[model samples]
Target: MDHLSTTHSCMEHLKSQNAKKSGIKKSGGKERPESSFVAFRAFLSSCDLFYIKHTCNFISRRVQKHSHLVHCHLDRTIGNNAWSDLFPRARSHYLIFEASDHRHIISTLDSKKKKSVRLFRYNRTLCDNLEITQLVKEIWNTSSACSVADKITRCRQAISTFSNEFYVNIRKLVQLKDSLDAALSASLPDDDSSLG
Candidate 1:
């Protein structure tokens, strides 16, 4: 059993135990409120191959006649009909079982993992990469303070150029719309009685 299954088993047992306490009687007539998780774990130890499940329960309970929060680690392993169970969510961290000649390992995040994204051609009207790169190189490689001022001036000029280009395109679009409207009107049947 994996950590997930162990967690699920623990949750099921806990639910059953809770139901028993709340007068929501189970099918079995047994009135034991204590869980059988520990015993289940012990039975798992003597097996050659075993499965474990880890669970994290956040339920509060009354222990010793007082309300207290309890976290139970349920480790249940099944091997050769013998079992050993634990309750902690089987974190990826594992202990070295030198006697069994098995070393436990956990997964770790890679700091050097590279992130990449595809640049799509969403706006074909935008300047191409070569033009932008050349502009950047010219601005960066310029030595004189006057060249910096020139770079700013060029940027402003580019902005104005783009602004004029946008208006020109808008004007063309408006003209086309007007032409289309004129064509549509021309194609309509002229009737003096329809003028309401």
Candidate 2:
């Protein structure tokens, strides 16, 4: 939700300043009408019911072309402790004043690290295979290092290499089996005379 009262007042003040420069009588040095302030205060009070003012960091500076006023208010729940979960590290920034009358206000929320998804793939052909069992036994018995961590690392590397090689071999065997089956079907007669 954007609160534009500060911007509206700034614009009114600018208009009044321009009028004074042109020898026009200012409205008793009052830029905004009394009724407008009263209405704005009422609106703020109503907003206070649902949100608490988190910060009063004004982005625009008074030295610039615009007035330094709290045009944007960062609000959060009064009793909600889960603000971090919603916004993480929330911050406000004032971008460079460009061609616009007012400087752009930027609000940012720091993103949390996302959890990585774990994938588990199983190959039934590799299970209970004598070659796979022998490969594991050979790698596990190999004296690559004296330390347990080093040995475990070596074993993991060996198993990964073996799995890659096994997968390639399995794919080749499957292709061969499919080609042999196709050739056998093609050689068989379409008619039932061969069955007799």
Candidate 3:
């Protein structure tokens, strides 16, 4: 099958790359030569990369949870539904970006819009319960109820209130500091320069 062959080839490529990386490293030591490619390969082998990979996985999971659709931009022609199945939630759209000379897939998470076709591949309880289904329907069918103008007005009002309070407090502090400094200067022996 094509899937099996593709999987095998991918595994083989990874193995070869790993072998090449190990070959570049100094014998019995992790310190790689100062060559740029060797440094990059060493970075791939580093434990920090494992942490970064885990962070990427976390981001992907979060995106999947929040979004039902994904859009991908890639240059090369891909197989039937290979990329789609990888992120099969609701509606997955892929576009080919041909301007970039190199072959790389750029994936973007699409916005959750009203009237989006719901993909119920998760827990059955989510769809089976009437209340849950109703909730999901309400979430998908209705756009943001708040108007942009109302949101802007509220934000501006908050900023104005904060600014007024901040300036008032600052003026009081400044007056208190001036009074304190005058009192302190009065208590001290007056210098000729200060009197002038």
lDDT of each: 0.36, 0.40, 0.33
Cα misplacement distance, residue 14 of candidate 1 (Å): 73
Structural similarity to truth (TM-score) of each candidate: 0.21, 0.25, 0.16
* lDDT of candidate 1 over 59-132, digit per residue (tens): 21211223322221222222221222333333223332222212223322222335875433224444564655
Kindly report which residue pairs in candidate 2 clash with one another: none
Off by over 4 Å in 2: 1-30, 49-85, 111-196
Off by over 4 Å in 3: 1-36, 50-95, 108-196
Q: Number of clashes in every candidate structure?
A: 27, 0, 0
| Better by TM-score, candidate 3 or 2 | 2
Q: Using lDDT as the measure, which candidate wins?
A: 2
lDDT of 2 by residue, 109-156 (tens): 553345876443545666687876776677667864457776666656
For model 3, how does the per-residue alpha-carbon lDDT over 1-196 read when each residue is reduced to its tens digit? Answer: 2444344321111212223333322222233344635753454344222110011111110011132322111121122233334433323232222233222223333324559764323444334656545544554445367576655444444444444554476677666655544432232323353311
lDDT of model 3, residue 99:
32
Ranking by lDDT: 2, 1, 3
